[model samples]
Target chain A: MSDKRNSETLPLAWIMPGALLLLWQASSSLGWLSANILPAPLSVLASAWTLTLDGTLPHNLGVSAARAVAGLLIGGGIGFGLGLLTGLSRISERLLDPTLQMVRNVPHLALIPMVIIWFGIEEEARLFLVALGVFFPIYLNTLHGIRNVDPQLIEMGRVYGMSPRRLFRRVILPGALPSILVGLRYALGIMWLTLIVAETIAAKSGIGHMAMNAREFMRTDIVVLSILIYALLGKLADSATKALERRFLRWNPAYRR
Target chain B: MSKNNGAALTLSQVTKRFGDTPVLHGIDLSIAPGSFVAIIGKSGCGKSTLLRVILGLEPASGGSVASDSDAAHARLIFQEPRLLPWASVAANVAVGLGERGDGPDGAAAARQALADVGLTGKADDWPSTLSGGQRQRVALARALVSNPTLLALDEPLGALDALTRIEMQSLLENVWQAQGFTALLVTHDVGEAVALADRVLLIDAGRVTLDQPIYLPRPRRRGDPAFAALEGAILERLLDASVSAGSR
Candidate 1:
């Protein structure tokens, strides 16, 4: 009975999108909507196909993905390291936390103009923007995760005479890992968002660049295709992170399913 | 270097203070090696604090607590299981090994410890999957895995159901006998103190008010007249101490 239900409803989530696409096709066929304003889904698909055949879509998609990953690694690594440092040491917290808190308040997007002035419209500016956008969530969550680990477990570690390093590895790190993964998931969301905006503003290549370039040509179909590509990529990145979380946090009862 | 049978722990005028509040007031006691001793007291009566001081989780403000062996060769089982939730049951138990090499050798020892605690097939299971009683058993495995010379339990079985608590008491005593570690259990349960300990220490207001020995043999029965007598005696001692403190 459960198997039958699973088969019946598992793809139920696709029904709405399918219905919307069908509605879009009917409206376009009946000439009820202007194609220039909002391209039909079929036209968008056709544009995607042509772009793929010409190697334009795949190349730009690759570039965007690479930039997103690079920014994530750079920002995520620094955030995680600093979080551990500040969380572990009172001296570090006192020294660096105030500066970080102040900086965290100013919107990261507002720095795009300054970033352009500093790094110009180069790839570095895009990377920096995405990195800055990704950093705070990872840093804040990592700090919270470490600081909130059960003190009882810490005492248990001490009772067993674990060295400081071992205590961090066996007790503190594993205890804080679920929260860190949560931060990573949030960071991934910000990574794509920042990259799209930065790329749209100034970029030689990438899906965001393609969308902006298509806007000038009034190629609404191509622009729609780029948006779809961004949506797919974001979903893909989210699913991958969720899979990683499942693997790492399987021992957590809350994450059992 | 000798594994002498008596007084593995010696406390000399040990005093612990939390800022202005003195929690342990010039307390002195001795605990024998290879024996089970229980410390019983009312809540906030410094029983747990005394265990912490003995375990060196906190330093005493005055005097000394010396273990006969290396301080590193000691372990504590807390009131809660306190298992590392992210680790497998075996890995959590293996944590008892403490900085020891952790590959196959540690795993084998962990498995053996689990078997000793009657959790032979649960080494790979996560702590979250275990029932409360099972989790505490895993904790016991962790405590015993290191082969520590001194094992301190701070109301370790307090959270367990009565039946599970009784089962754990037998398991604890059997393991203590087999391992021959000097065991110190701090608990509020007078019956528990009488059932398990070779000697029971009653504390009130940071002082050891009564130090009594239980001559009851192994596999002690709660229904036994002598067992009931001992529990009654310890209860009276605690009550008398509180009454005197109230009067003073």
Candidate 2:
């Protein structure tokens, strides 16, 4: 019965997408659905091919990728430093936590207008938006990771006469790594989302800009292709992050299993 | 060096209390170096507290503890293995050495320590994958890796099952004989105390009431008459304390 169920479900997963494509092709051929609003899947694939052949896809992808990477590094670095400080020191936590909480409560997207006013609709403004989006999750998780380290392990380190630096490096950091990785994964996703949003509003060239330009020209095929590309990029980023997480947390029971 | 060969722990007029309730009354005791001292007491008698104070993990309200302070690198084996769940068996054992930066050489030392505990084959295994007994063996290897002057044990085998506990007791004996470090074990089991220690100290109401030497030879069996007699005598002292507490 289980094998039968598995065999039935296996085809259903493939069939759903196949049936949708067939319906889309039939509707477009019969002129039931207008190409202006929803272009046929074949047309979207053709536009994707044209964009790739003309190097437009690679250029836009490179711009977005570079921006995302830079923003992640800057934001992740600051978040990790501040999070470790606040987590390890009670005084630092008392001094910074309330102010950070209040600031973090404000939606980062809401600050785009102010950011544009300050830095203009330049690269700086877009980078700032991506960084802001990346910061919160990494900071929160790093702090959680540090705070959750076992007190017994700390005592063991002390008893062994470990210097403060050695204790942090050998015991505290490894103990907190699993949570920090979780934060990194979360922050990466938000970084991409914020990057696209920022690019869509003001950027001259990027996937998001491409989608916007396609919409203006009523090139629904290009827009659909760009959306598909964005989805693929997000999935690729997530899978890479997962691979890194597994590599680092190999000793963790959950990862081992 | 000769004077340091016997167990010597000196606690001068120690009095400990938690809030208004006194746990250990004014107490003074000196143990010779190299002596295997087992402290046995009923729950709430402050035996564990006494061990903690000796280890400098806790402070006594009144009294000073003077040991060979230069021998500051004492190792403790807890009731639970307390192995770091995130570290492999080898890495956990090597934690005592801190970050030596010697790489393969330091790893070899860790391997040797695990081998001493008969865990060489399981060096790369995580603590979670190991059985309760194996985890305790890993903990024992961790403690031994430091070559500590003082080995403090707080019911280290109290959680093991009967068969495993006995096996661990033998392992402890073998390791103790091989290393010859001064050991202070806290236990509620009178039989365990008699079986393991050169001398047993019975604490009742936070005060040492009995300090008896066990002259029984090494490799003493639990079923032996000498071991049974010592166990009975410790049991009697514990019962006498309870009876006195009731009369009070």
Candidate 3:
């Protein structure tokens, strides 16, 4: 039954990735692909092991992680706050939504040059770009979710004598939660992308910087290891969000574990 | 818990307009405390609007509406159950208690209400898991949980199948009898009106064309001669109004 499938889901997921890794190792060991272009999986693992021993991998990873978390907190908090404001008040929406929509259409990474000019390659430069990247999806989705909540349900809440605060907490927030989670997932993706681009373009001490340094030295193994780290982090972020969805949206059959 | 909880409401010259279109025109009526009153009309005849205007859901354009109970003590059962989809049945029922809905005492009251509605085992279930009839029962429990002084029912059983509707009607009658709250039901079914209400008001073209009082005993039989007669008379008037409107 579904229980059995649930138990096997993790193993089932790793099967394809495991096979791909083996095939990649075989190709690299046989010299079918040159080491200059692509390093073997084992060599990448060896490089990762060395980086860990030297404290480079963990240090760069911690820095990248801290940046990502800070950006998410700053951007998501502001976006959600603004979304609640604009979604509830028509006057706020009229005043702010147009400007937000215009900014949303621009590729956030394209602001890299201007951001560097403003912050002079400081941590703020990277933080600004990543936060900007994470802002729109969360904001737009939050606003849309709030606006589309069933009006009838809201009316029912009011009739049931729910005060203004309880009305939002009990009715509006839960109703908009599913959509807001979706926005978080989208913003997570943009978070990684913005971080990678920003780190490569500026004086950075993160995974992207490590990869850039390896590329200059033609250490393709270390470079591939950094790429894999980004991939792993993205997967981890997605799983964390899914866990949150399961916890918060368990009342919804679609989200019930 | 007693008939003292029943809310008597009175409205005079109640009028409602949406933009240029008028939905209700000068509706005037008084509901006695603890009495079950059913309002019947064809679709768009403004029976629902009249109920809403009195309940303050839709503000009357011009009128005086007076109720013994404050708006907080009034509960409405919409045609759709309107249960919070993300909350459990118990939690949704507890919503009738407002801010205390998540508190332990509210949960206890919600369980009692659910038991009253014969849904004692489904408190943890989601609204999506319930049948349509069960969902409406949950809505009823939620409305009853707060011990409302006035309960406004807007064709609450209109969408149920015939058998479930009858079962729900009997349940409603039982709850009204036990709770002693003022019940205002709006429906198109003459049989339902006859079977449930102390008085049946017939509305046509935004006016109360008829107000017939029922002297039937508790748990009135739909097959009884008096019930049949009242149902028939209302049906005849309703059909006549429909025909007259069509021709015009």
State each model's C-alpha RMSD to the native.
2.2, 3.3, 1.9
Per-residue lDDT for A77-187 in model 2, tens only?
889989999999999999997888899899999898899899887889888888888888899999999999998888878876778998898789988999998999899
TM-score of 3: 0.95
* Ten-residue stretch with the least lDDT total in model 1 chain B: B1-10
Which DockQ values do the candidates obtain, in the order shown? 0.84, 0.55, 0.82
How many Å off is the CA of B168 in candidate 3?
Answer: 0.4
The C-alpha lDDT values of all candidates are: 0.89, 0.86, 0.91
lDDT of 2 at B223: 92
- Better structure of 2 and 3 per DockQ: 3
Clashes of each: 1, 10, 0
Give the top-scoring candidate (DockQ). 1
lDDT of 1 by residue, A1-257 (tens): 86888899979978998899899899988899888888988889898899999999989999999999999999999999999999999999999999998999999999988999999989999989988888999999999999999998898787777899999998888888889989988998899999889999989999999999999999999998888888888899889988988898898777667
Off by over 4 Å in 1: A1-5, B1-7
User: Compared with the true structure, what per-residue lDDT tens digits does model 1 show for residues B1-248?
Assistant: 12334339899999999999988899888887788999998888898999989988898999999987877777888899999888899998988886563888889889999999999899899888899999999999898887888889999999999999999999998888787888999998999988899999988889998999999998899999999988998899888887887887
Candidate ranking (lDDT, best to worst): 3, 1, 2
lDDT of 3 by residue, A103-167 (tens): 88998887777897899989999889888888898999899999989999999988777788988
In CAPRI terms, model 3 is classed as high
